[model samples]
Target chain A: MLKLISSQIVSMNDIEEEILDRKNRKKSTNMILCEKVIGQILEEITLSEYDLIICTGEGELGQTYSFFSSLASKDHARPIFFQNSLHNSTLGSVSLQIPNIHLGISASNGFISYETGIEMALASSSTKPVIIVGIDAYPKELLEVKERIYGNEIKLKSGACGALFLKDSTSELFKSHKGRVLTDICFNTHCEAPTSREVFPANGLEDILRKLSQNHTNFTVNRPGGDSIVYSFES
Target chain B: MNPVDTISITGHGLISPAGIGLDALWEKCLSNNSVIKNGLGVIPKSDFSKVTQFVENSKWCKSIPKVKSKALYYSLFSIMSAIDSAKWIELNKTDTIVIGTTTGNLTSWEDSLMSYSLGDDKDQTIESIREQSLGQLSVEIKKTLAFTGKVLITSSACSASTQAITLAYQQLSSKRSVRAIVGGVEELGKLTIRGFGSLKLLTEDNCKPFDQNRTGINLSEGGAFFTLERNSDSPYLLRDGSTVLDSYHMTSPHPEGKGYQKSIHETLELSGLTKESISLIHAHGTGSFHNDQSEGFALNAIFGNQVPVISTKGVHGHALAASGAFELGIILKVLETQLIPPSSALVEQDQEIDLLLPRKPLEGKVTNILKATLGFGGVNSSFIVSRRDDA
Candidate 1:
């Protein structure tokens, strides 16, 4: 089983402010939401070594790959990245700085896209820690739609990219102890109202995991609310 | 395992230059003719005209309010077709809507570029176009259809819609309580045209797929959608689907078509069917030298000379994200009618490839069919659909 070891939340305020500080910016959204969200997370995972890096968001790896290509002054870009821009490029970008890294991309849509990507990362290897980044700053137009959905008075705040460093219990990192799957997620997309109107947060994620670590057991039940909707079980 | 709960393709609606209805599209398919020509428009304005005649002919065009962007038109037109085909009522605000596109409103981008070059306040133009492009289309579709379900708008260059289809299949097969409306939509825009032009990949004339004289692909705009159900009275059954990342390149396929080969094998494997069971193959023959050569090599490797192969781009032009779904719709028609549509408008055939190309509609019972595609960003997908009669 894989356990989320440590989670890091880097608000766009830090690095984005850095990138914006350099350029005389006129573009309404200076956040470079995609670049900052993807780049900053890459920066966080630079120290640790991992078997694979998985990036999930909306869109292909072209722009993300190019950012890494320029950062790494390789004489020629990897044909693999140039051809397919495999999933590892996300990690490869940082791996260029980190070395001996393999990465893969899982660009899914909406919230589940991020969740599924995390699930994959956790399942990849029990011993190695996988970095998962889920950061989506609303697109310009989508911002307006979010505004409409949230209401005119409310502005959809840019989403923060949440990076979780996940490792399997079997890894040497956790050899002395057993780690268990914290959340078994399945989506209920058939609500009568929009999820925005119906979701309740799963605040117990951390506490439940801690309790399971002590008990080394399993429990399952249906719960509503939190960042996503579904049943949660802990052992 | 009797009829292991297959994904139901309850409804789909398509409006191409061929016509507004399935019958109309079938007529064009039977005639082996395409209605797409270079479009007539002002922004990124081209005299080349890859317009779908049905778009010009449909009442939907007259009903839609004039919008600044053409992407909205394509989005709306395809939505209407999908709604009509699916005959589905409004979702409880929880159904998932996934759409794919390469150039979301390229016309607007073209306008922005032209305006920016002229030192105009491109802010509003850029903002407006970007809004209506991909996410905007999903919002509009949600608003128009009054859908309350979650909306997922994917734009993964060429693999956009295929990803949508693949995701939808995974969700349903995973036993998730979800219904997905998945497909791709693309309207030709100057950005893509100019981009392809910059890359020297667009053909000056209509594309000729799988031909030795294949020049390059022609960019066009079209949208096709499938309303997939976990269980329902869909006209056909989508037995299995799969997506494989070539991890190869961003722009070109592996010269050997290894990615495509992997996708085919996985798709067939997922469907629990052998290649010998495939009655027909809908290939992603973009008429480009590289795509044709790579796809040709892949087909030869998989089916040898026996399986009949067809590429619709010769008639429909290359529809970007929607190409795979468009080809799937054609396969559905073939399955329903048991008639092999004529491989449209190919001027020459690649002699090195050993496969049958139907010059005219052929009568044959096809229980299972394969539709394969290779898109930009090294995303390749193949879907296996079993005829409803098979169930």
Candidate 2:
């Protein structure tokens, strides 16, 4: 059984503040948001206790734009920007901050990226704790591009959601709290939800965390293109 | 045997700089000729255009609108080839598709960005931007194939496809899906070329891995796919695999190759195999100094000079995320032919590297082969493939 130890959600506003306040901010907005949310969750559990880290998203689009912009202008792109432009760079940052975790994965499935991360975490055979983080940050520069692409129907937000999961064991960090047992989670390509919602990579996991906070035991989150992630929980 | 160990590689397809299809790639490997021209492992324009035209004319192209990205074309062509090789007319709704990619539709994104930068928004379209999503690769595959199951995309740099294969193994082992279409695709683009160039990791000459005069990697692009299932009758069985992080550096690997060692150890432990059981070690060997050195120390510590090792980056170039899948295809050929291809572009071996590097094709009683790949940000993955008869 996989048990949710603790989870944190960071809004776009908070991520913006963190990005602005950092003096040495060479990282991408997605990396900054991931570190912020994962940092909050680490306050509850020791970093060393986690055995795996799974980062999910399309990657640092802002950095990608910057790298391309540099090239378009006949300028040498920064090596750091090139390195951080990778989707897995966010996971690399987390691994650097917390050196104990030996396994790290960066996955992306667009709006259902969070669900994909959850599925991967659940599928892992490791019995130790795992940390799954879903992050998305749309740079202001890409707003026009996004507008042309997603149109008005889909509202893409910039934020991050992080969760700590333990398999077949309860951690002392959440011993006093009543942890929600994640009974089953799977991705369905067929849409069964009543209504369609905005497409944000981190929203599905964010919605689940909100529902769990309200003491809701069972719920489902549907993605765009008739895909849905069904979540079942037990107290 | 464990159910996880039951997963087999039923079929595979390839599109590399060497050529298209598994036969072309294997022939190139055996010929020991470096396909790297002008410092890039690129698919010949003829092969590229041929596959594009074939995909456009194929029945799979009827459903979706015209795709502008070469990455999508490569992926579709490879998947169709894999399914054809598997001899499956239809796919089950419960089947899953996992793709590993370093750059997904990057060429499209580059064009859009360039146009946008020039204030020319005429070419930018919704479909083009949607295609930029790494996940969109699998979605397009699903639409063309009409499968209503789980879709995943792993974008973990160089080891992305290896991780995808490992995830498919886990999914089938856990009974989440009975069969999976697993592969990795990368397309050559300005972003990767200039990006690696800025880091001074690109070589103008041939990429010579583990060679004393090794300079840097030659970036390449291609795709390879495999049909994995629980069928025991398959010729090749995916023994097991592991992915581990170095947690040491962003671009450079641990000097001692600690992460790679751990990954190899864990894969062996889980697969119930030992060092002596592996017939060949397909090293990542990007021809980059740090990667080759790190992997060299790791392999030396683990296998000493007992296991024969080879790196084919010189022939096909480093396809980044697709390199592991390309090597896996080569490994399958190695098992079938009972011959190990020589490491291409090796003039003199690096004295510091202690492992045995093959300079010529060796015929042996091949059975289990270990394939390992290390990517940027210290992601290391290792897996074993064995002949079914041996099992």
Candidate 3:
């Protein structure tokens, strides 16, 4: 079994909405927002030892593959970007930063993509650590669709992406007494509820954290029709 | 390890060049009749003309109702046929509907491209059908089957269906659910056509597997589904199945067939069986020179030349992600009838390859058989199935 040793969510590091307004940036692209988060996360952690890495996305239209592809090689002299880039280039880019890494990508349209990445991290035969990233930025022209799904009129143009380094619970990579507990993850494809509620993807992760903080006991949160994330205490 | 002594294939639906029903296709296979030919020439009310040029000379094209788009037509038909087969059980008896499709209405993209080139109206654009993405497919399936269990859609390229089958088996074996409708669907589209063309792997004629003169693969479209149950009276059973990643190449197989052999060996080992016991091997013979040569080498190295091997690609053409499930449906039919289909287009065999390329359909008491498939991203999978009576 695999466990997450380290996890990070990249968001607008220092750039405020006021800064964007001052710059007169009219379009909101989640890819750029993800770039900010990725920049911050990379600075804080090292992913050199992991065996497998995955990058998932809902941002940076058409730039998804290239953004990751550019990170494939660490060489600063020249940057290589190709058209029709692969779906998992984010992971590939990370792999370039840490050579000898197995990489994959799952951009399927829902929470299952998240669950799938975690499943691979947990199930991989590699004894080394694995990094899983979920990044999505606001779609510019498709704001209405995103708004309908996310359910808010707030002008938070910047999107955020998070990363987790998963390993076996027994692995030496994770520092003792400093870790996130993953309780259970379930994906419901055919949800039966007549009127499905707006269960944001973040709710899945947040619920596990909130449950631990409040009841100090196990709790369950349904993502409804996709993957549900959870965290439990290391009892 | 899950010991599948009780799981069985209770029901299934098939739509191939042989026609809409499983029995119809089975009868054709039993009679050793070829449903594949050059072309249907003129199919009525079909968007067949829209993509007919893809398989112009190929005789077998799995016909679904003419939807506004071809890809959507195939997926909708497969789902309907699966729901129809699931009808064998009472409504709401089982709620799990898992679909495996690689090209999720990709034909929509192809049509949209054509509309763009022809300067068609934006109102007439194929974007309307783009909602038929893989995610939305699950929603549609849930509505169709009225199923209440989990619905999973897998799009792992060619291994899509095999993974679906394995997932379904896991769900049932864990006692989470007793029944599942699992299969795959794929349709011909310009994107795939252009991709394969760029790869220079498209065959100008019917696909000829294992033949020394085999040129390339013909891209075909269709859907196949099997209704599996933990306990049933079905004649066939899934003995064991496993998947392994090559981690070697993104697009090509390991020259030595290491991953393929590993997957097959592990499957046989898990099934507690030997290669000699396998009555036949349904190979992933797409008529591509590399695919046939590599697969032939793997089968030869493992099972040797004794076991008879056959390919259905010649009949159904290469259905991409749907090939594995379609092949599974065919294998189930063979086990039920105790006869194997003949080599449709195979004439001369490569002496370097050690597989039995029989000219006529072989009849035997095939108690156990193996079906192997390798897909893009080094996804290799094999399934070992046993006859119910054998158990």
TM-scores for all candidates: the values are 0.70, 0.95, 0.72
Across residues A1-235, which tens digit of lDDT does each residue of candidate 1 receive? 3554444444446555644664523121212433354455456445354433233332322332232333234323333323222222232233223333322334433334454454444323124555555444443433443344334333334443534354554455555433344455433433332223221111123223444546644443222211233434443
lDDT of each: 0.55, 0.81, 0.56
Q: Write down the DockQ of candidate 2.
A: 0.68
Q: Which ten residues in a row have the lowest lDDT in candidate 2 chain A?
A: A192-201
Write one digit per residue (lDDT tens) for candidate 2, span B1-391.
Answer: 3543588898887899988898888998888888889999888879888888767676645465355577887888888788788887777767888889998888876766755655556644434655667777767777766667888888889999988889888888877787888889999998799889989999999999999999999999999999998865887888668889988888899999998999999999988898888899999998999999999999999999878999999999999999999999999999999999998789999999988888999999999999999998889998999987744
Q: List where candidate 2 sits over 4 angstroms from the true fold.
A: A15-17, A20-23, A51-56, A169-177, A190-199, A213-218, B1-5, B56-65, B123-127
Residue B310, candidate 2: C-alpha displacement in angstroms: 0.4
lDDT tens readout by residue for model 1, B28-134: 76787766565211122231122233344544343333343555555555655666567765565445666766655555544543443344544464454334223
Q: Arrange candidates by lDDT, descending.
A: 2, 3, 1
Could you give candidate 3's per-residue lDDT for residues A165-224 as a string of tens digits? 555567545655265555444444333322354332322333344465575644444554
Q: Number of the top candidate by lDDT?
A: 2
lDDT of 3: 0.56
RMSD to native, candidate 1 = 8.7
Can you write out model 3's per-residue Cα lDDT over B24-103, one digit (the tens) per residue? 66665555454544521111234344233332222222332233344444445554555555555353433455666665
